[model samples]
Target chain A: MEMKSFLIIGMGSFGHHLCRSLAENECEIMVVDKDSEAVEDVLPLGVSGRVGDCTNIDVLRSFSIDLFDACFVCMGTNFKNSLQIASFLKELGAKKVYAKADEDIQAKFLKRNGADVVIYPEKNVAEQIAIAASSDNIFDCIPFVEDYYIAEIRPMERWLGRTVVDVNFRARYNLNIVAVKQGENVIPIPGPNYVFNEDEHIMVLGHINDIRRVAY
Target chain B: MEMKSFLIIGMGSFGHHLCRSLAENECEIMVVDKDSEAVEDVLPLGVSGRVGDCTNIDVLRSFSIDLFDACFVCMGTNFKNSLQIASFLKELGAKKVYAKADEDIQAKFLKRNGADVVIYPEKNVAEQIAIAASSDNIFDCIPFVEDYYIAEIRPMERWLGRTVVDVNFRARYNLNIVAVKQGENVIPIPGPNYVFNEDEHIMVLGHINDIRRVAY
Candidate 1:
């Protein structure tokens, strides 16, 4: 694999996590934060850091920002600082810029200014939590798309004796039973004749709406 | 709905977002951060705040932390401090504790120390980005389970004229189409007779492993 480099503009939660993830991916990462203490905290991760204000063009230029493969502007909440840093990264000709945004307005600012991708990590996590909260019966809720979810759900008592073919779950629930876990074993792609085991935990692929509609 | 109160330590991206989401759910919230600016920035949201070190048990005690229904520790990458704060939250009798981690080791520390839930936001984003990176044709990837993803992709040429019933996507690909977006129209549940439109964006739910097998 070819080596890549990144300049992370903050040491906040989102930026710190992204830096670690990129480091695990074997990228050369350099982090910057106005607080030298924050910079010092990340030093053990094998990533270099320096106390610098990313919003200043000179501070960014000192690090040769344009030469890095990408620049992560992770100051999501501060509108002025984030926008300034994003614009400067693009002006310096960074190959790609990824920014963190706290809201749709911030995302718009990042996109219009220069970000290649703008992510809202908080929103994503909250949405997942909301799904789990709403689907109380489901042990876990994994959002797939607008309405679809991949979830670990217990079959309603009425569903225990039916076989896959008898219910035609695909048509009835707009879902597929991808796997079933009976205690320690995972049954992937169970045959059509497979019965809904009362003691097993099934991985159901369907709309969250349909899953909510099931009468427990 | 029964309203709950929460104490959020570290007003970084993750905590700030979660705090906002919980506030929307009608929960009373109080936030803390060493950075006074961060605490000040979030005050407009109607949540109260105090500038203090979460690792300091006395500081936490001053806030009457145990009275809150739950607590969120969002100091990602600060292993020692995060562990201390999480342990202190439980010792103070907070009903639930959610902490943020940057890696497996940190997550383990949080779990062992007292965190009821430990989330890795960077890992979540990287997995989503990796799916998008690997499947160049897929526009979006939302993870549902260990191996499943909800993805949006352009229909293959062969699928353009076919109806859903004739294709039997679930059997053929271990996937289901939950919704489709054509221009401004979003079809939440396309009927069996629904034909794949060339201009539409189809939201497919399936195992990421199976989605990877698609020719497109």
Candidate 2:
């Protein structure tokens, strides 16, 4: 795959982590923030840097933001500034603009203003983590969509000493195991003959309802 | 499932959302925050409340915190205080301690200090959103583990008009579709003969490599 170019506006936690992940993937990143210290800290991480207020259209124009494939406005605490920044990014002809919000209402506002995607980091994490904690054997819950979930679930007492095929998981429970997580290692596309064990974690995909039936 | 009790240490965005989810799931909730206003907002969501610093062991003792099944520390931007609170919760005999961290270093620190699970809301959301933005067909990406991903993807030109059995997605691509999201409706465990439409998003589970093979 070709490298992606990203313009990250703000050096908050969301922007910082995004830059780090994109850098690890060999993407070219240009980061802007009002805090000089924040921009300086990320400079050594192979990202180009600038220090300026993101709400100003002139600052975005000076950076030639239109050249980037996507831009992220991660001003978590500043709703007004983030909205203005999102609108300005769209006006600058950026291909895609994503913004971070503290709550659901703010997400709707960002989406209405011009953000291609409005993200709520806190809500997303809380929902995933909360769902995981609620279930007895689910170590984590990742939503593929509203109906389907990718979950790390331990083998139930009834499922012990059984192979994946023996359980008739797909037909009986409307679920399928894609991988086995042994300790910290992930074994993907495990064979149907793979046996279930007490200590291992199985990663499965299914309707959230079917997942709960086996997970609990 | 029987009723589960949760004690939320801080009423920030993450805690507030988690509390709301737990309440909606019919769990008993006890929420505490130094800022009374933050606590007040979540009161209508069917949660009991207290106003105090969870970092102080005495404040926690007053609440009889050991009775709760789990506790969540959502004190954003206060690493030291959050870590201190996690330690206090464990010391008081809380079964599990979950914490929110802004960075990897903080996650390590929280884990060492009594947090059984350290969640990085920003990093988790950023990584998912970035992967979604990078791929043309991927509407969303959820990591099941380090190697496996569950992604909502639109069918590419090669996949258009093909039936599930015809494409042999499971055998050829090492992937399986769990659901089909058409407009606002979700069709879970979609039939094998279901036809692919350009407007619908199919949620599939596979290793990251396989997801990318189909994503682009």
Best by DockQ: 2
Per-residue lDDT value at B126 in model 1: 61
Model 1 chain B poorest ten-residue lDDT run: B127-136
Best by TM-score: 2
- Evaluate model 1: give its lDDT: 0.75
lDDT of 1 by residue, A1-216 (tens): 355688888887667767765676566888999999989987888999999887779998898877887788887557888888889889988888888887778889889998999977767776565344333356666665556666778887777889977878777877777567776555665657889878988777676667756613
lDDT of 2 by residue, A80-142 (tens): 999999999999898889888888899899999889988888887787777788877888787
| Per-residue alpha-carbon lDDT of candidate 2 for residues B47-70, written as tens digits (9 for 90 to 100) | 899998777789999987788889
Taking all chains together, each candidate's TM-score versus the true structure is: 0.68, 0.87
User: What are the per-model C-alpha RMSD values against the true structure?
Assistant: 6.1, 3.4
Worst lDDT window (10 residues) for model 2 chain A? A141-150
Error of 1 at B122 (Å): 2.1
Native-to-model Cα distance after best TM-score fit, residue A138 in candidate 1, in Å: 7.1
